[model samples]
Target: MRIFTGVILLTLSTTSAFADCGTLNAPTDQQLSSKAYQLQYRMEPDGLAVSQDFSVLFEVCKSDGTAVEGTPSVDAYMPMHGHGMNYRAQVEKLGDGKFRATGFMFHMPGKWQFKFDINEPQGSEQLTADHMVK
Candidate 1:
C-alpha cells in the first residue's frame, strides 16, 4: 500500500512538471520543424525592424509532443548577403524546452534566416525559418 501511494505521488509530480512545460499554444510568428523536433518562436515587441535589437522567445517539442532536452542555440544569417548577424544572440534555458534569446539585430532589410540548433545525446538537428525585414 505504501509503495503504491509513493508511485502515485511520483507519477503525479512528474506529470505536473511536464504540464508546466506544456507545448506552446500561443500565437507565434515563426515555426520550424525537423524530423525530430518542432520549434515555435516570436520576436519581442511583435515585429522586426532593421538595425534594432530584439529578443525572441521560443519553445521546442519532440514529434511526440514532449519537451526537447539538451542544448539549444539560435542564430541568423542572410543567404543572399552571405553574412550573419553582427551580434551573437545569447540563449537562456527557461526549462521544459523553452528558451529566450536576446541580442538579435537585423542590420539590413532583406531575407534573413533564423537558425535553431538542438544538440541532444542522440544527435543534433538544425531548423531554419525565413523572415523578411522592412
Candidate 2:
C-alpha cells in the first residue's frame, strides 16, 4: 500500500490551481471527490546528477464544489539530505487543471524530500512530501 502525506485540494472549486505529486495511493478514479492532490514521476541519473521529472495534478474546488478555473504556476523542489532542496523547478501550466513541473535535479540522493510551491493571484502555498530514491 502506498502512503500519501499532504494537504487536500481535491474538493476545491475555484479559479485556483495546484502543484501536487502522485503515488500508488493516488485515487484510481480521476474524478476527485475530495480535497487532495496526486502526482506521478520518473527519476533518471543525468551524468553524476539525478534528475527528477514529475507532474502534480490536483482537483480543486473554488467555492463549495464549483470546479476552479485559472492557471496556478507550479514548481517542485528536491531537497538534499543536509540542506533544504534548492529551487530547480521547471514548471508550466497546460490548461484544463493540468500543470507540470520538471527538471528537479538532485546532484546526490539520500533521504531527500520533495516540496511543491504553487503561486496564484490568490496567494501561494507550499507542500512537503518526502521519499527516498535509491
Candidate 3:
C-alpha cells in the first residue's frame, strides 16, 4: 500500500510539471523545430514585400512546450545570392519565450531564409524558415 501511494504521488508531480507548459495562443504563420526546441514566427503587416522593411514576431519553446530561457537572435540571408540584408534586425524579448525582430528587408529577393539562433546554457542551435518574395 505504501509503495502504491508513493507511485501515485510521483506520477502526479510529473504530470503537473508538464501541464504548466502551455501551447502558443494562436496558430503562427510558420514553425521550425529541432530535437530540443520549437520556434513559431509570423511576419508583421501580414505579407512580404520587396524592398520594404518589416518586423517578425516569434516565440521559442522547449519540446515540452515550456518557454526557453536566454536570448535568441534573428537574421535573414539569401543563399543563392550569397548576401544578407543591408540592415541588421534588432531583437527584443517580450517575456514568456516571446520575441520581436525589427528592421528586416527583402530587397529584390527570390528566396530568403529567416534564421533564428537559439543560444541557451545547454547548447546553441539554428533553425531556418524559407520565404519567397515577389
Candidate 4:
C-alpha cells in the first residue's frame, strides 16, 4: 500500500509539471492579426535590428500570460525595425521545461537586435529582445 501511494504521488507530480508547461503554440504576426491571443517579443535600444550577444533573453506571452519556454522562434528584437537582420542560434528544448538558445554575435555591437521565429505546426510565433554591449 505504501508503494502504491508513492507511485501515485509521483505520477501526480510529474503530470502537474507538464501541465504547467501546457500546450505550446507559435503565432506569426500574420496569424496574430487574426487571432485574439498572440505573443510579441520586443527588445530595447531602438533601430538596430540586432542585439548585444550578451543580453539576457526577455520575452512575453500572449497578453500577459506565462513567460515563454521552448525554442523561442523570435525571441529578440529592436524597437521599430522590419524583418531583415542577421541572427543565428540553435534553440534547444531542455527536459526540465526550459530552453537554451546558443546565438552568435552580430560581428560588432553598438546597438544590435535579434528576432527569433519560433514555430509550431499550427503557425509561427515571434519574440524580440535586445541589449547593448559596452
Candidate 5:
C-alpha cells in the first residue's frame, strides 16, 4: 500500500508539472514546471557554494507560454539526505511572474532539489528542478 501510494503521488506530481508548464523539453538545465507554473531558474555567483549565501531568480510562465503573476516561493531540499536547507529562502516579486529568492544555500555537496511554488488565478502548484553540487 505504501508503494502504491508513492507511485500515485509521483504520477500526480509529474502530471501536474507538465500540465501547467507545457510540453516537457529540456533545452536547458534550468527550467522546471508544475500544473500551474513554469519556472526558469538562475543562480547567482553562477555556481553552487556550500554554506554560502546565494540568490536565485525565477521567470515564471503559463503552459501556453504566457507570463504569470502571483506569489512565488522557493525552497531547497536534499532528498537523499532526507533534509532541507537550514536557511529559509525568501522570495520577492519582480512583476510579470519574475521573482527573486535570496539567502539560501546548499551547505553540502550532493544532489539538491529546488522547488518553486506559485499562486495565481488558476490556483497554486509547485514546480521542481534538481541541481548537482560538487
Candidate 6:
C-alpha cells in the first residue's frame, strides 16, 4: 500500500544518510606510538563536529606491532581553552586491542586533545592525539 511504500522510502533515506557520513577509519588519519603501545583512531562522521555525539574507534597494538588486551579509558580536553569536554566518552573493549568509545561531544570546536589511557599486565601508557574541529 502507499503507507508501506512510504516506509520503505524513509528507511532507504535514513540508511543513505548514515552512509554519507563516511567511514572514519584511515591509516594515515590519526595515530600515536609509545614505548608501551601504538594506537590508531578515527572519529565517526568523518570530521569532528560541535555539540554532536560521536564515536571513536581505535586499535591498540604493542610496541612490537601486535594486538594487545588492555583496558582503555578515554578523555578529551582543550589545553588552549583550559577546559575539557562537557561529555565523557565511555570505552568498551572489543577484543584484539580494538575499542569503541561512545558518548563524546565537544561543546565547541577547537583544538581538543583526545587521550586514551591503556592499562595492561606490563603497565599503563597514555596516548594522545590533537584534533582541530571546525
Model 1 misplaced stretches (Cα beyond 4 Å)? 1-22, 26-29
For residue 97, give model 1's deviation from the true position in Å: 0.7
Task: Tell me the number of clashing residue pairs for each predicted model.
Answer: 0, 23, 0, 20, 2, 0
Model 3 regions lying over 4 Å from their true place: 1-29
lDDT of 6 by residue, 46-75 (tens): 678888789988887776545777668989
Name the 10 consecutive residues with the lowest summed lDDT in model 1.
14-23
Off by over 4 Å in 2: 1-87
- Residues 8-33 of candidate 5: C-alpha lDDT, one tens digit per residue: 99888665644454322334788765
> 3 or 5: which has the higher TM-score?
3
Error of 1 at 22 (Å): 6.5
TM-score of 4: 0.38
Model 3, residue pairs in steric clash = none
Expressed as tens digits, the lDDT of each residue in 1-134 for candidate 2 is 12322223332322144323222234343323323332332332222234454444443333332323554443333444356445555655654444555555554565655554444465555445555555
lDDT of 4 by residue, 1-134 (tens): 99999999976865454344333332232122112123332222222333345322223333223334444553343344433335555555543333445564444444444555555444565544355634
- Cα shift from native, residue 85, model 1 (Å): 0.9
The prediction achieving the highest TM-score against the true structure is: 3
Q: After superposition, how far is residue 62 of candidate 6 from its true place, in Å?
A: 0.8
The total of clashing pairs for model 3 equals 0
Instruction: List model 1 lDDT by residue over 9-68, tens digit each.
Output: 976865554445446664645767665677888888778999888998989877656788
**Model 2 deviation from native, Cα RMSD in Å:** 9.7
Which pairs clash in the backbone of model 1? none
Report the poorest 10 consecutive residues by lDDT, candidate 4. Answer: 27-36
Model 6 whole-model lDDT (C-alpha atoms) = 0.77
- What is the C-alpha lDDT profile of model 3 across 1-134, one tens digit per residue? 99999999977865554445434443544867676787878888778989887999888887666788987999999999999999999999999988889999888859999989998888999999888999
Provide C-alpha RMSD values for all models, in order: 7.8, 9.7, 5.3, 12.1, 8.4, 14.8
